[model samples]
Target: MAEAFTIRYIQPLWFIWVIIAVYIVFYAVFNHTEINVGAYWFAVITIAYILISAFVNPRDEMYASIIGMPLGILWAMYERKIDSYFEIGFLRKEIVAIVAFVILFIGRLTLSVVGFDNQLFQSVLRNIITIAFIVPLIELLKKVKIQKRFLIWLGTISYEIYIIHPFILYFFEKETTEGKQVGNLEIVLWTIGLTLLLSSVLQIVQDNLVRKVKL
Candidate 1:
């Protein structure tokens, strides 16, 4: 809902790079204190999710109940012209974007140093950082193409995928070794195959249901 707005806008590589730089600045707030990069990454995934979860929208850290529901209603109320919000002169200002980036960067850096190394404190701090930068990130992402097909497909079934994917993963893991590492590429392919198959069927069923209700 937030990101559907900037698709046709000009997004230079530098623009994308600047956004990456912003995210890094925001991220480094928690990270620069730690000298080891590998340990830093290990900490990000300390939540016991599968490796693919970090990159998959169905498994993204953000949730529909938390993020999707309100946005869904808002997108409806706006009649899907939510992208036009970017047309505001203040929001489109380069200086506004830069200030947003720097404030986010400095705030996080300050938090990182002041908060020290407490994990719970850092988690709360990161959420604060997200509050500072999420607007700019969404502003930047709509113009950028991370994975066009995946984004479109996920956008279409964004709510459903979150619910369906867990079940797919549960069954796939259940039928397999369950506890051991899945080292086979074929097994990974099978997971992909199953997700596509099941998700397509679900989408079809959902479309039929929506059509019946005229929604």
Candidate 2:
């Protein structure tokens, strides 16, 4: 379980950060003229790596997220651009971007689902599909007016939730293995609720500690 988790989650996170740092350095050293160009290059390199990895080592599925990191960064950059459009009430460019994103998303998903069983290829396609989905999803989110207080709190603590949820899962598994008679649905609900509460507390503690250290 530890090995599988490391391979599936930890290694991919490390790989993505390494690639992101490399791209950041490359942009700073060579072409600080425009960030969008850097994002484009990062996207291109990520895609190229995916394709190459597909041919070279089709079994390594973790490398697929190499593309996802850049695509996420690119989406962030694009979100900034769209903010500018929103300010000026000029949505034509955003609309075009959304349409392109939809097309690429569909293509990527189709390839991922219906294409060959090659791990590398499927993983690359999945990364592309996720990347393609981010743009339009963000665009749609921009139009949404979310006003719920609980939702706002959830959003604030989301990063903590993400980090702590795995521990919750682990604890759930341990409990079940020890013959705890919790139902599956009960375990899931308890995990989620406990994760939320614990993560929020953790975040508060972290914030306070940071403040104290800064002082």
Candidate 3:
């Protein structure tokens, strides 16, 4: 049982936990500072992920959870390794997503406790947590047949939705800041509405594009 758990839950990239720990240390120190070193480090890491992904063959590292989830399926299909698809089950998919969300939420709450304005913290926390969890959860959920379809959509045209969401929030924040008092319910409703509308619009656009391109 122990060996099975180890083989299933543990992947080759366990060292990433150490990397993330270091990042969290820097993030804690720099989150509200003028130096913005955390953001710079984030940019560097993003660049590295993009570069590393390009060089690695899609087969060997396919089952790595988080960003590797969807890539694994693609690699499996590419390499005809469908029989070994059980390798991905090692990850308790929702557990990791939940943990990531909790970490981000606590991080933001810590920032608030340290003297950042409540309004600012509330304004940014939801969106930031969503993004932080997206990639972390995607790899696990993507391995499931049903969620694979949804996540592939997210993976494909994600940039458009990501960029557009901030502007959408900016407009909403402007309205609230101008005169409209944003109650808790109002904020909740706005988030639900914005997420649904934007997600639907992006899905439709992606579907149309896929059909046009014969993908």
| Winner by TM-score | 2
RMSD of each: 18.1, 7.0, 18.7
Candidate 1 vs candidate 2, lDDT winner: 2
lDDT of 2 by residue, 10-70 (tens): 4424443444454444445324435656566656766677677667864664365455666
Indicate the worst ten consecutive residues by lDDT in candidate 1.
63-72
User: lDDT (CA) for every model shown?
Assistant: 0.48, 0.63, 0.51
Model 3: residues with Cα > 4 Å off, grouped in runs: 1-164
In candidate 1, what are the lDDT values of residues 1-215, reduced to their tens digit?
22354533222122233233333432443344442442334334332222233345443233212222223224444633545666566355535766876786687678778856444444445554454455556656676777778778766775455445555565556656457666568666776677667777777876764444312
Candidate with better lDDT, 2 vs 3: 2
When 1 and 3 are scored with TM-score, the better candidate is 1
TM-score of 3: 0.33
Overall local distance difference test of candidate 2: 0.63
Weakest lDDT window of 10 consecutive positions for candidate 2: 9-18
**Model 1: lDDT of residue 84:** 68
